[model samples]
Target: MDKKIVFITGVSRGIGLEIAKCFSNNGYFVLGTSRSDFDLAKVLSSDECLHIQLNVTDRNQISACLDQLKEIDKVPNVLINNAGITKDQLFLRMKNEDWDDVIETNLTSVFNMSKLFIKSMVKERSGSIINISSVAGLMGNAGQVNYSASKAGLGGFTRALAKEVAARNITVNCIAPGFIETDMTDHFQDKDLENILNQIPANKMGNPQHIADLALFLASSKGNYITGQTISVDGGLFMS
Candidate 1:
């Protein structure tokens, strides 16, 4: 196994799946996860891929996956905290469960996953942790207070973690994507989508591949010097 290993969450579909493919295509071994059952091997031609049925918010399930990695003697060189969900509703109408679920999955899962893997990276003196955030985290969204807070918390988490681990040669960063064409937006009507596209100066929705490409770059040697930064891929939707 000369190829580097990357562990990505939420690989059942959308951006996570695209990142898995991109890494595998670039000669990486992919250890991917999803809340739902997914067969990544069917989509990836690589024999070096493994898929885990995982709920990122669950420590027990995450520990089970940790056991699987140990069985194969694989320590991920990169970790992408990509698993997330959005229960969209007006702040006045939001449920407590919605807020809790979003925070646990979107924010705390970063804590869970990173804590599990960072030990090995620290021992090896090399690693990259990429947190997938959202523009809503930076700019706020009308119907997504929970989701926004979760991702915003991730940015803070990334920066502080980056500083702590930089001495160990591990880098932590966040990617805040604007409206990408994933299932998360599949519910949007044409008119609703038009309103979103209108907001983006580029006047278009980005594909999952766009996000995947950057993930590759960040995990590569080219990104060795970059850390503690939130890079937005939102077609100029939110410039900070």
Candidate 2:
């Protein structure tokens, strides 16, 4: 069997980086993208992995990265849209730029990426697209209106795209992760952290590897039947 080719965005650190490493270790040809040059190179040092600089906020950068992938004949079997940002402020106080930035990075980029690659997957009649949403998308949070909107948009995008491409054997799904231990969450105060944990059934922060493992399965053959669903990894934060 040919080795799978996987492309992941925002893979410099945290969950994205862990997912990249997991795919690479499993013998996939992993291509990871980051905005930082040094961090991109550092994360994808192995022969099985290639790192490229990509700012999803910039269309030109995304196009350039696609061109590089085409040149190398590395069309991906799995495309993980994990790049995102948060501009947290109450809805009333949120600046226009803050809302636009979050939408561009987290929501619009998925549309761009899916449009770019879904055709190829359609032609091949097999592929998987895993989007990283958040539990905040499903359950609204205070001071996170923009972030919530972006993530919620991703869920809609996933379901619509899944319906569009289901006959072509392409699965589109979103993983809505809860509070995970990463640099992003590290910014929370101890009190805030404790309050958040108190709501989780597990009563602890989820490891990055746990989310990575779920992503891996969703990208693998075992997940062929799964599509148009938002699976939460938030230790029973919201049960629906």
Candidate 3:
């Protein structure tokens, strides 16, 4: 049997990086992407894992990247849309560019990626596409209207696409994580951190591995029946 291939974006660090390592360690070939180049030696030590530079928001770049993957006969059996950005601001103070940037990077990029990869999966009659969303999209955050909107959009996208591809045995799902201990959440002020901690029943921020492990399950054979679901790995911060 051929080794399964998993393609992941925003893999330079954080949840994305951990996801890559998780799949690679499990004996899958991992194709990891980041907007900027990083040391592959540190990010993914295995030769089966390759790091590629890609800006997920750029449609042309996405197409080119897919074409390159084709040349290598390494089209992925799983695609994880894990690249995202946050521009936290009160709605009254938010700039249009900020909103656009967040939407493009977070939500629109998923559209681009899924469109490109779904055809191959459909033809193969099997695949998993896991999108990394946020708890803010479900519970909403005070100064993150843009971020919330983007993540919420992903939930809808995942459900609709799951239905579309279910007949083909292609599963689509979203994982909405709460305050994971990533660089994205490292900027909180002391008081703000205390307030956030007070709201969580777990009383602690989650690690990237928490999200990675969930992603691994969703991408594995164990998750074959799961589709159109937005699973939360937010340490009981927001219960649906």
Candidate 4:
């Protein structure tokens, strides 16, 4: 049997990298995209993995990446839209550029990528699209109006698209992670971090692997029946 293929965005570091490794280790052909000039030899020196420099905000780059995958005759069985950014500032003080930047990267990119890939999945009649959202999108956060809005848009996108593609046997889902320990969260102060921890019923920061595990499950056959859902992997921070 041919190995399943997965294409993940924002995979140079953090949760995206972890997810790529998880799928690769499990015998999936993994293609990872990062905007950075990543040393693929140093990071993912494996035949099962392909690393490409791609900026999700750039439409041409996204199209180019998809073209590269097509060249290999490996249409992705799963597409993880994990690329995102946060420009934290109060709504009143937020620059228009910051708002547009976040919307384009986090929200608009999902629309573009999903639209591009859905046709292939529809023809094959089997695929999964996992979107990485955030708990801030569910509960909302101060100084993160732009980031929260983008993530919230992801939730709506996942649900609506799931309905559109469900008849074709494609499942669309969103994973809203809470306070995972990554370079992005390293900027928090000790007290602020502790306070955030206290709010989590699990009383701990979630690891990137934790999110990766859930994503793998969703992509696997076990998750075939699931669609139009947003699952939170945030250590009980927000119970729905």
Candidate 5:
């Protein structure tokens, strides 16, 4: 069998970076994309890893990425729609541009990215797609209306797409992370952090590795049977 290739978006740092490193350490060729350029070798010494500058919200960039992959003869077996952004604002105060930007980056980008790869996947009759969502999408948050709605839409996208490609051996799934200790949360004050921690039953904040490990499982053959479902990894903060 050819060596497996994994394509990850927004992989410069945080959970996406961890997932790339995990896959590389496990013998998968990594093709990671970010809006800004990043040196993949800085974190891992894998010759098989390639980092591409991609703006997921741009259709031209997505097409160019597909063309480049085809030229390189890299058929990605796993596609992780991990690129997303948050525009936090109260509903009444939120700007229209904020909602549009959040929706385009977080949700519409998934549609474009998935469409770019699903054809080759269907031709091969095998693939795995993992979406990185947020717990805000599940239980909702006070000031992240746009962010939450985008993530919530991912659930519907995952289920419908899963059914469409199930017969073709492709699986689509969503992962919602809660209060992970990433740069996204680094801006919180100590008091704010303390308040957030109290809500989590784990008492400690979750790490990027926690999300990465689960993403690995879902992308690998281990999670072949799991599809059209949203799994939360929030230290038991929001239990359904």
Candidate 6:
């Protein structure tokens, strides 16, 4: 049987890396991308697993990458929009560049990638798009107005796109992770980490695999009926 293909962004490390491992383990051909170079030999030696350079924010780069994929006949059955940036600041103190960067990287990139690939998916009548959002998107967080707005916009984008593609048998969903133990959260001061842990019913941060497992399910046939949903894997930090 031909291996299924999954295209994932921001896969140099962290949640994106874990997602690539999950799909690769499940016999999917993972086309993982990152802005920086990475050593894929550490995790996947399979010829099927491809590591590509991509700046999701750049439309030209996205087009070129997709064109290359098409040349290799590696159009993906699944697309994961996992590349995002945080320019966190209080709205009053946030710079215009910070807000613009976050929105473009986190939100607009989703639209650019989705728009490019969705045409093929529509024609094929099968595909899954899983967006990696954040719990901050669901419940607003202080000092992250720009981040929150970007993710919240992603949720709405997921819903609207799901409706548009449902008839074509394409599913669009968002996975909003909360307080996952990644490099992104490693900079949290001890006191800040303690305060965050206190709010979670699980009393701990989530594992990146927690989000990966859910993403795998959503990308697989098991999740055919699920679409237009923001599934939170936050260890009970925000229940919704």
Candidate with better lDDT, 2 vs 6: 6
- Poorly placed runs, candidate 6 (over 4 Å): 1-3
- Give the Cα RMSD of candidate 2: 1.4
lDDT of 3: 0.91
lDDT of each: 0.91, 0.88, 0.91, 0.89, 0.91, 0.91
RMSD of each: 1.3, 1.4, 1.2, 1.4, 1.1, 1.3
lDDT of residue 229 for candidate 1: 93
lDDT of 1 by residue, 1-240 (tens): 233999999998899999999999998889999877887888897778998888888899888888889899877989999999989899999999999999999999999999999998999888999999998999999899999999999999999999999998888989999999988789999999989999999999899998899988888889989999999999999987
Q: Which portions of model 5 miss their true places by more than 4 Å?
A: 1-3
TM-score of each: 0.97, 0.96, 0.97, 0.96, 0.97, 0.96
Worst 10 residues of 4 by lDDT: 37-46
Candidate 5 residue pairs that clash: none
Candidate 3 displacement at residue 30 in angstroms: 0.9
Worst 10 residues of 2 by lDDT: 38-47
lDDT string, candidate 6, 163-185, tens digits? 99999889999999999999988
Task: State the weakest 10-residue window (summed lDDT) of model 1.
Answer: 1-10
lDDT for predicted candidate 5 compared with the true structure: 0.91
lDDT of 2 by residue, 7-79 (tens): 8988888999899888888888888888887454455567777888778778787787788889989989799
Segments of candidate 1 deviating more than 4 angstroms: 1-3
